[model samples]
Target: MKKVAIVQSNYIPWKGYFDLIASVDEFIIYDDMQYTRRDWRNRNRIKTPQGAQWLTVPVKVKGKFLQSIRDTEIEDSSWAEAHWRSLTLNYRRAPYFEEVAEIVEPLYRNCGDLALSQLNRKFLEAICRYLSIQTSITNSWDYDLLEGKTERLAALCEQAGGTEYVSGPSAKNYLDPVVFKETGIELTWFEYGVYPTYPQLWGDFIHEVTILDLLFNCGKDARDFMKYTK
Candidate 1:
């Protein structure tokens, strides 16, 4: 059966995002949804000496609520350089710094004012490439389907020729199982349970930070590390 997963594009998302991508045959970037402030749409956590800190990308909002991710724009281009420096200083001593640096440093140099969704999609692609994930990824807008939560998602899955849709745990609350069944599709839920582990840092490994923390400390072993808990 054709399997697919749908998720909103996140900036430097957590390890679970990669897990979902690896688990599915096709990963659909649901970027057509509304953007929210102080959400994963443009920021994520990273490990720091001070503890877990947020790395945020400024966004320009037209109104109180984001109508769509496509309408959200990056507010400051300078933040990219600052964020790069912060990551460099924190992870310079990491085992995989050199390898990941070569892959991530160019992102800062290529920064420009773009939509939050677009920037995140690019970052997601970079992370997938670095980890050698072969899943085919596509954006929701490319489907040319209907809009709205249920209709949009169901139509997108159909357009992609997906018979099964894997969704985040939160989707369980709103998604009607019967609706998906009627559409000739199966709904599967993904729940990521990340166990705490020591990273290559000062002392006492932190948890729930961005996937960068996992990459920096575990390096090439990050993939294996994730599999242990699963």
Candidate 2:
């Protein structure tokens, strides 16, 4: 059966995010949804000596009350440089920092002032390449969106020729499985927190930080600590 996952794009998301991507045959970037403030859409945490630190990408949201993530614009083009600097400062000493940096550093250096959705995709594709994940990534807008959250998700999965729809655990709070059942699509929840600890640089191990943390600390072996990268 063809498995599919539709998720909102996040800025340098945690390892679990990539695990979900790797678990599916087709992954849809659902940036057509409304952008939430102070959410993972424009920020993510990184491990530092002191503790986990946030690197937030400023976006233009002052007047736009209900803007979609695809429509969100970066407030400052320099946020990329600042974030790369933070990563360098915190993870320069990690075992695999240089190798991962060679792949990630150029993305930051060349990222232009693109929309939030476009920016997130650039990083996601780069990391997927590094991890050798071959899942097909597409956009939600590529298909005709239907009304209702459950209806829309089921429709997207069906349109993508997916017999099964894999979602994260958090969506169980409000996601109606009956919709998928009616559409004849099997529904499944992705499990997180199963990853093993790696050679992290910080004092305490935090699994919620960005995937970059795992990449810098474990390099090519980062897939060993993850559940579905293989």
Candidate 3:
């Protein structure tokens, strides 16, 4: 049975995002959906000396409420340098930061993708590779997108030939099980917690931050951390 998940691309998402990705057989990037501002689509948190800080990519969403994530563009070309510097300054002292820096720094150096989806996809792909996650990644636009929320997800699962669908716990409020049952797909929600605190650079342990925190601190053992407790 193949497990599949459809999710909007996120900017250097947390460990849970990769946990879902690693748990599924095929991970679909639902970028065709409308881009919502101030979401994980283009920003995420990182631990800093002061506290947890948000690092957002400046995107041009001036007046386009209906703009799809695939069409959203970066507001300026300079955010890359600033973000890299911020990451460097905050995480430079973390264990294995230098090792991860060699792997991730080049992504900032060659920033050519202007679209938010494109940027998120590139980073997600690289991070997955680093974590040794072999799940196949695809895009929502590649399939026939249906109309409603549950219908769209069910149809995408069918198109992807998924026998099971894995979802984040947040979707429990809106995801209708009947829709997946109609499509002959088993639905399961991923629950977070049971994350053991590792060596953090900051004063206290923060569970919710970008996956970079795990990678920089844990290094090659990052996959061990992404395996959420059952």
Best model number under TM-score? 2
lDDT of 3: 0.90
lDDT for 217 in candidate 2 is 88
Better of 2 and 3 by TM-score: 2
| Backbone clash numbers for all candidates listed | 0, 0, 0
Write one digit per residue (lDDT tens) for candidate 3, span 104-137: 8988888776588989998999988888888999
Candidates' TM-scores? 0.93, 0.98, 0.96
Instruction: Give me the overall lDDT of model 2.
Output: 0.94
Model 1, which residues run further than 4 Å from truth?
Answer: 62-64, 194-198, 228-230
For model 1, residues 1-230, the per-residue Cα lDDT tens digits are 88888788889998878888988888988877777777888889887788888999988775647478777888889999989999998899999988888878887788676678878877788888878788899887788867567767877888899999888899877887877888999888887875557555855666667888888777767877674223
lDDT of 1: 0.81
Instruction: Give the residue spans of candidate 2 off by over 4 A.
Output: none
Positional deviation of 198 in candidate 1, in angstroms?
Answer: 4.6
> What overall lDDT goes with each candidate model?
0.81, 0.94, 0.90
**Candidate 1 accuracy as TM-score:** 0.93
